[model samples]
Target: MTTRPARRTRRTGPALQAAGIGAAALLALTACSSSGDSPSAPGASSGDSSAKLGGTVTVFAAASLTESFTALGKEFEREHPGTKVTFNFGGSDTLAASITGGAPADVFAAASPTTMDVVTGRNETATAPTTFVRNRLEIATLPGNPGKVASLKDLTAPDLKVVLCDETVPCGSAARKALDASHLKLTPVSYEQDVKSALTKVELKEADAAVVYQTDVKAAGDKVEGVEFPEAAGAVNDYPIALLKDAPNTAAAKAFIALVRSPAGQKVLTAAGFLEPAS
Candidate 1:
C-alpha cells in the first residue's frame, strides 16, 4: 500500500509500438525531402526532361538551305542520339504552302523573310523568327569566261542564254529587284522554280549565265565560275527560321532552331558560302 507510486513502467503496448512506427515513417519522409529526392523531383522530371528527345522532327526549308541544313541535321542526330530530322527542301513559297495545307512539319526555314511572313501570317509559326544568314545575288557563268557576262546589264544581251529564278521564288524576286534598280532588262531562256535549278543550268553549261545566290555558286565550286556583279548589292536576301505552331515535336524543333543559331551551325552554313546575317 505504501508503494504510493511505483516507478511507472515504460509504455510497450501495441498502441505505443504503432506510434513509434508512425514517427519513423515521418522521419524517413523528412530525410527524403532533405536529401533532394522528394515528389518535386518527379514534377521537375516532366519539365525539360532528357527523355523527350527521341522523336523525329520534320522540317520544311527553302531549297537553298538543303546542303547546310542537311549537314546540321546529321550533326544534330549525332549529338542528340535517337533524334531524326527529315527535311523537305524546296522553294520557300512552296514550303510555306505545304505547311499551310496541313503538311506535317516541326520547323520552317526560309531563304527570305517575305516567305517566312507568309507562314507566320497563317499563325503557323510557333515563335518569333530569327535571321540566320544573308545571301546576295551572283552571276554564274561557264568556266573560263565563255560568255564574258560580267555585269548585270550584260545579262540583257539578247545572245546570252540566261537562266533566272521564277518571280515567285526568293532568288527570282531578288533578281528582278536588282535588275530593276539597275534599269536592266534580262530575257532569261528559262525561269527556274528555285535557285538550285537556275544554278544547275549554269553548272551544266546549259545556260550561258544565270543569276543565283552567291552560296549556290560556291557550292557548285569549279562546276561554274561565280562572277560577282555590282548590282548584287541591291538584292540581298535574308534567311530566317522558326518553329511551327503545330509542331508535332516541339522540343526537337526548338533544339534544331537553337543549333541553327549556334556557332557550329553557322560554321557549316558559312563553309557552304552563306554569309552570317549582319550583326
Candidate 2:
C-alpha cells in the first residue's frame, strides 16, 4: 500500500460568520470551496421525480421548518427503507451562504425568495426553486399576554423587552416589512439569528415579547401567546426549495423534495401552521 498525506484546507468567504447557527454544525464544510461539479443530477432527469431514492439526503433549510421538516424526514425514511435523512436547519441567509460556500448539501429550502437568491445567484441550484409554503409574522408574548401587546405598536413600549431576528435573515426581513407597513419603529433588546431563536426569547421569559412567525407560536404551545396584527399580511414570506447543483445524493434529494410538495407533505406542514404555497 502507498502512503498518503492529509490535505490542508483554508476557510473560504465568511463561512464561519453565520453565528446564528452553531459553528460546529457547519464544520463539515471546513475545506476549500469547489467551483462545484456539473449542475446536473446524473441519474435523475428533471424535477423532483428522481432516479432511485436511496442514500442519505442532506437538506439545509430555514429554522422555521424544524418541526414540520423533522416529521417529513421521518416519513421519508419510512417511505424509502435503507434511506437516511439528515437536516441542517438555520437562518436562511446562513444556510444559503453555506450552500454557495460548498457545504455539500443535497437540497436548500429557504424562508423567502430573497434568501434563496443568495444560492441561486451563485448558480448553486440544479433547477428553479419552488415555493413550498408561506408564513406570517405574529407577536409572541408572555404566556398570559402580560404585556397587553394588542397591536404591532404595543411592542414599541420602552419598558417592554423585545427580541427580533437579525435583518439578514428571512424572518427579520418579514418583521421589518410589517413594521414598515405599520409605520412602527422598534428597537428589540437583542436581534436573534433565526425565527425560532426570537420565539425562544419569549418562551424562556428572557424577553417580554418577540416578533416571530405564527407557526413558531403554535409550535411553542402554551409556553407563549400569539397575537396577530393586520400588518402581518403584508409581510407573509414564501418559502422556496431546490436541489443543489452539486448534490452528492441527488436521487434522494429529488425524492425528498417531491415528498415535501406532495399532498401528504402539505398536510403535515399545514398542521404545523404553515400556509399553502401561492398558486
Candidate 3:
C-alpha cells in the first residue's frame, strides 16, 4: 500500500492546492449555515438589539406623572421616529391592580415603591424597579393660597375644606406619613381617587386645599399654589420605573425607560418640580 503524503507537508502542486481550497469552502458553508440557524441574543444593553424597533410602547404610570411623563413620551417618539408612546395614567394602586390583572403594558412607573411592589411582588416586572426621582408632599391651595394654609397641620383647621388622595394612593400615603411625622390628625372634606383629583378639588374651588405632590402644584401653574412644609422632608416618595415582563414591544419600551432615566429626561422632570433621586 502507498503511504499518504505527510499531513503537515508543504505542497505547491495544483492537486494539493485544489484540495485545500475545497476544504476551506466546506468550512465556510458550515459556518454560514450555523450562524443563520442560531437563535439571536436575548437582549441588548441599549434596549436596541440588532433588530429595528417600531411599535407602540404602552406605559402604565402614576397619575402624578401626567405632565412630566407626557413630555418625556413626546421626546421618546421624536428620538425613535417609527415608535409610538401610549400611556395609561392613574392612581398607582389602580395602575398596579390593572397590571396584575393582565393589562398589556410595556412599562410601569409608580409613584411609590409600595405600589411598585404590587407588580414586582408578582414578578410582573423584568427587573427590580429603579428610582428615577423623588417627590415631596405640598399643600395645594387655590391660586394665591386664599386658604392661608401654611403647613400640613393647617389643613386640619375645622373651618377649612381640604381634599386628600385616597389612603391607597402614593400621595395619600405620603401625606399620612407626613402627618404621622408631625403627630397630627386631619379629616379632609373628601378623599379623592388620585392626587390630580384631590388637587382638582382645590383648583375647582370645591375644597380649600389638598395634600399633593409639589410637581402637581407646579404643573397647575396659576390654577394652584404650592406650600412646602418641613414635614414633607420626612415623607418624600421615591418614583420607580420598570420594564414589564410581558412587554409587547420590549426594544422600544426598554429604550423609553432608558430615556426616562437619562439626563435629558431628568431635566424635564426636575423642571416640573420633581426632586432628583436619592443617591
Candidate 4:
C-alpha cells in the first residue's frame, strides 16, 4: 500500500467559508443585542432614564427658603458633578409673577400653597407640587428684648414700631389670619415687600418688632430675638415646590427636587428651624 497513497490533500475552502459565516453571525447577533433603539436595552436612553443629570438649573424660591435652599443647592452640586444651581429668592408672590412673566426658571418653591396655585394657574408648573416644609409666624425683636413686646396683643400697643410683610406676600397673609384669630388689630409702621425685609427692620432697630417666619429669626441668629406667640398656631404657612413647565433644564430640576426631599435636605431645613411638613 503505497503507505499513504499520496497524502490526501485536505480542501480548506469549506472550512474557511464556514468559519467566515460563523463570525458574521456573531457580529449580527451583537448588533441586535446592543441595538440602542431597543426599548429593553438597559443602556437605552428614554423617559426618566434618559434625563441627563448635569446642567444649570435656575430656581425661584420664597425668601423664607433662602438659607436652607442655598445650603441644599451647594450639596446638590457636590453630589451631581457638572451641575450648577442659580437662585432667585424673594417673596413668593413676586417670584410667581416673575415666572408668569416669562423669566427663565427651572423650579419654584413657594412659601404658601396659595401662591403656588397662582403660578400653576399661569401654566408655569410642569409637575405636581409637593409641600416640603411648614413655618409659623413669630415676633422678631431687637436683641435683649428691648421692646418688651410680649404677645400678639402687645404688637397692637401704641408707639411700637411693628413692620409686617406686604399683604400680597405669604407672611403678610398669615399675619392677617393670626391677627384675626387673636382679634387684635395691628397697625404696622410699614408693609414690607418680603419677610426678610420685615425682619431686617427689627435687626436694624428701625422697627421694634416684626411678624416673620420663625425660620427667618433663626437665620438672623443674634441679629434679632424670636418670640413665639400662641396665635401663630392659627397661621402656619406651607412651603411647596414644583418644576417649571418651560424649564431649560428639567433633569437638573428633578434632581434638585429629589435633594430637597432627601434626608440630607431635611436636615438642612430642620437646622434652619423649618418644621417638617405634615404627614
Q: Tens digits of per-residue lDDT for model 3 on 1-279?
A: 322221111122444433323343234323433444322213312234455778899999999988777767766665567888999999999999999999899999999999999999999999778898999887878766666767676788999998989989999988888888778989889998889999889878999888898877766666777777777788999999999999998878887887677555665677667899987
Candidate 2's TM-score: 0.82
Could you tally the backbone clashes for each prediction?
Answer: 0, 0, 0, 0
Off by over 4 Å in 1: 1-52
Locate the minimum summed-lDDT window of 10 residues in model 3: 2-11
lDDT of each: 0.76, 0.78, 0.78, 0.78
In candidate 2, which residue ranges exceed 4 Å CA deviation?
Answer: 1-52
lDDT of candidate 1 over 5-49, digit per residue (tens): 111122234454333333432343334334544222123111134
RMSD of each: 26.6, 15.9, 23.8, 26.0
Pitting candidate 1 against candidate 3, the one with the higher lDDT is: 3
Model 4 TM-score (2 dp): 0.81
Per-prediction TM-score: 0.81, 0.82, 0.82, 0.81
For candidate 2, write residues 216-250 as lDDT tens digits.
87677667777877788899999999999999987
lDDT of 4: 0.78
lDDT of model 3 at position 139: 81
